[model samples]
Target: METKAISLGRSLSVPFVQELAKKGLISVPPRYVHTDQDPPIISLDSSSPQVPVIDMQRLLYEDFMDSELQKLDQACREWGFFQLINHEISSKLVGKVKLETEEFFTMPMEEKSKYVQQGDLEGYGNMFVLS
Candidate 1:
């Protein structure tokens, strides 16, 4: 009798998302379907206000600590999110990260589906689904 070894990195025969997209189906998947009240996608003005930019450099200073903290608090309280500035991460590194991210997202769905989650986990995912 011959014995065969199972490969951990082997992928499924077909990618589920690619197959669904090829069929022209665009409904939200089970994970994204909200059972609660519908959030407004737009207001009467339909304009997206600018996000607050919180400067980390100022937050680290003694004189600006309280003021920056208050600004951060206000941003969260009002906007639910804010853009972080002067985070100290190098610009070159940030650019590299952005480039790599674009590359990853541009890959063919069939190639990416190789990383689909199994019983426990897989590669990168939005916190909404991965969590």
Candidate 2:
């Protein structure tokens, strides 16, 4: 089978929000305001939109496999992300990771800067590449 590389056009350089915040600007600059974009679609119903949920238990069972797979595909297409349930990873481990992530975010900028993205999108930095 022949394979082709997919290109996302180019990497878009965005103004560093930290530097902008340091400037103490009262309002967001007009350049950052996207007036051309349509307003977000909000449902009027009392119930809120939910993050797609995919249960691994259903996926593992023979009878539910096909339907679960379809749901997973739909979730990926419509929501871009989904909350995974019945994943073997314990809640304790999840909590530890969450706490560590929060602590990392709370670290001083000088400390965080040590892990700043150098070239490829692997470390802490703005990921605003325009396609």
The C-alpha lDDT values of all candidates are 0.71, 0.80
lDDT of 1 by residue, 4-119 (tens): 75435533343245456777876856644567755645645547556788999999999999999998999998778899999999999999999998987778776776765563
Question: At residue 115, what lDDT does model 2 achieve?
Answer: 88
lDDT comparing candidate 1 with the true structure:
0.71
Q: Weakest 10 consecutive residues, lDDT, candidate 1?
A: 122-131
For 1-39, candidate 2 gives per-residue lDDT tens digits of 998755434557766566688889999877677887765
Cα error, candidate 1, residue 123 (Å): 4.1
